[model samples]
Target: MTKLKLSFLFLSVMSLAIFVACSAETETITKEVEVIKEVMVEAKSTLKTVQDRGTLKCGVNDNLTGFGVLTSGGTFEGFDIDYCKAVAAAILGDASKVEYVPLTASARFEALSSGEIDMLVRNTTWTASRDRDLGNDFTATTFYDGQGMMVYADSGYKTIEDMNGSTVCVLQGTTTELNLDDRFTSAGLDYTPLTFETNDPLQAAFEEKRCDGWTTDKSGLASKRAEFPASAGGPDSLVVLAETLSKEPLGPLTRDNDSNFYDVVQWVVFGLIQAEESGITSANVSSMAANPTDPGMARLLGVAFGDGKVADFSFGVDPTFIQNAISAVGNYGEIYERHLTPLGLTRSGSLNALWTNGGLIYAPPFR
Candidate 1:
């Protein structure tokens, strides 16, 4: 071949090489952009926000007996208060590092939506409207409850049907209100509904006989009944009716946009229930995790993976977050008994019972 023909062939090959390199570089750049889009930087913002604040701001009821009520020391105590501590324990590793925002039923969702609080665990029900319209996400039903009527034992009202056309007091802006209305109307009973913004005045009015019956979540009634005084015929005076009006599955509440935060709160809830089922108490967690042979238990307790790699679920939580949380707060049943049992609430035969016991309280597998 001539030298000119050899040079022409070399130039064509060089041109093809340059074109392929440019196309490959362009494809690589496009993939980099797509990966950046998928990373969801905003999802990390919630964890960062809580960390920066140095405390989790929890919204809670100021005066619901079993769920949330302030002690003489001004510290809140109840089933709801324990949950707030669990979230803090999971996020900050210190259960006490929390700013409690006491909110009325009407103000709880507003506070959550406006970012005034990190979460609301104020015995709020998980309803279709709140889940879809309130721009908030509900995670795990921490407590299973039902709306019911609370009447003075001597009021001659043995059942809900006996109280028709009577005056009933209930807190406004709760499922209890709507449930009460529906129950009475469905039974073709005409009753007067009196509303309160909080439980303090609502309980006062019932004790004062301002209303013939007080209606709210049955758990709330039990808590209030536990606190009743001898002047008002004591706790035995008020009886929560046998008929449960509506289902109330209470749990953690966060803004809908914070999906990462949602996962963190939800798993924290699941962690408690799972801990109970696995027989992994706070006492046994450390020993169990030191070298758990069970794959699911190892994953849940962040024990040895039986492989060299550290167990990481990658749910924007610490590998040992469940351990920290469960250690700070015991399993779900323990928390309930600690705060709610004194209120005459029991887990047996209720929806709050474990799934193994024929109830709805089952947690998904951690593995």
Candidate 2:
């Protein structure tokens, strides 16, 4: 063969091999791009997920007053509901953008575990078993309560011991149920357990005298007592026994495996208490924001300094988020007064008071 013919053949083969190699490289690049896009789509945190969803799904109690209750106007009201609203304000920038799911004590955990609700704001107790066993996390205790028994004031039973052989009505799926059994058995008292699935039935049975006593958190008993029928001798007809059964440290709950969402919730709640401690209220929040001089206050409200640098704690929330929440619902104390105070519950000298005043409602510093 001629030298030119041989050289031409070799060049053609080289070109063909280069074309195949480039085609393979392009195919690999396309696959990697697709994978990266998929990872990006799946990498969203719960905060972002909630933002995209446009509302916070909160699990709450629909039966109890001073904590959670549905009114005749078809709206949720009370302490737990306010906390849900405050959380919604902080995260979604609108307190009204919330879906309140009324749940029973037995159903609250299941709703949270299954992602049916983003959070549990019902008066749920934080137990060691619940904390360690369930794939969930508990934030600061919002309300400090204890289990107690309620009976007719004229029932002639002054104490739990005096009620031996009496039938007590109680919710079936709650810490109250266990406490009732434990206290009665330990006290060597014989009492019939009238278990109920929900509060309506329990309240109905109690009103109809189907049970001699009603057992629940002391705060719940107060709520129920406030609604006692005039035909049943009015609210004074029911009296809560003084025996404290269990420490019901109630609070909000979040699911596990999402650290960002947890941090957001934890800090927002603590911030409410902190705001109250700082004497910041909805009425004066605007002035504080406009002329923030306190380092902590300025930092919390995201006030820019002379150099235009605002404090960044990396919480993934707007600096104005806490202020907005406070403005919408006031601080924790305001929330309590608005709902609980009317129920004949006082914060002073109680477990729900501030830490400075010898109570458990305290907050961590923003710094």
Candidate 3:
């Protein structure tokens, strides 16, 4: 082992080390580049991305009356359905441009995540777990509802406790069923859940005494009662218990990561509330726009008579998007009265009243 031989060996080892280090660095750079590409691809495929592709696709319940029902006339109608139209009216300026995809509770989230629907306006409850873990971003709550139990008027069941051993009919895969299980178990009561896919079959089973009671949102029970057949003694024959099993803040759901789309849906709902709060109804909206002095009204209507034109408030909507919404679907109270009030529900003392009235229906300032 001469000194020259040892020097040659050291040079060889140094060259191999440099080669390995450069190879590892190259691999790291490649991996980082791949990650950035993946992120960009995902961001481009979001709800706003697809909505920009033309029509807004809305996911709604197919069978729940007064909330989201597909009529035999082939048109979708209900409280939730109107919100879908409102979103379309705001974003696209044409309420009729929306494509409605009827979805079940079990499939709602999947549809939104997979881009099967651009937005979901179904009567879905917003919860902490769903917000953080379900990859969804819930906009402002459009309907504040509570879970309740309903029994036949002739059943002699005055309260939930009285029907401890009864078989309860509930739609499967809903928060309603989960709440029913929680309340009954906490009370050490024995009950069986007769679950169904849709309300029609559930009501049929309930009418025939296949289930002793029905459990759902109080608002939902009222809606079902209003539509119940006269052969069952009409709507007054069903009674919703006073016990509220759970809090259900129902609203529009958008995919997580599309802040623009989320804002559009949220503000459309808020616009309706703000319109109602400002004494602007569907009938007077056109007249109000003609005169337009109120600052709130001006901002809402996208008016610009002096100085610079109003800045386009993004959300991929025209400045007068809300005005179109009001003209198309009316204000929050108007919608509630048209769809919910006839179902024997009231806004007083409930979470549906305006915030100034001590309820939860508050909206962000339009400006």
TM-score of each: 0.89, 0.87, 0.85
TM-score winner, 2 or 3 = 2
**Best-performing candidate as measured by lDDT:** 2
Pairs of residues clashing in candidate 2:
none
Tell how far residue 76 is off in model 1, in angstroms: 2.1
Span of 10 residues, lowest total lDDT, candidate 3: 38-47
What TM-score, to 2 decimals, does candidate 3 have? 0.85
The digit string of per-residue lDDT tens for model 1 on 1-367 reads 2347546655655665566567857665555545443344443356668977889999998687678888789888888888889889998999999899999999889999877998899998999999989988898898888888888888889887888779999888999889888889999998999999977788788889999998887888887787788897998877777888899888888887577788889999999999898888877777788877678887787766777556788876688888888898888888988888887788889888899998888999886
Candidate 3: pairs in clash = none
**Candidate 1 similarity to native, TM-score:** 0.89
Off by over 4 Å in 3: 1-51, 305-308
Query: lDDT (0-100) at residue 141 of candidate 2?
Result: 91
Assess candidate 3 and give its lDDT. Answer: 0.82
Clash count per candidate: 0, 0, 0
Candidate 2 to truth, TM? 0.87
Off by over 4 Å in 2: 1-44, 305-308
Better of 2 and 3 by lDDT: 2
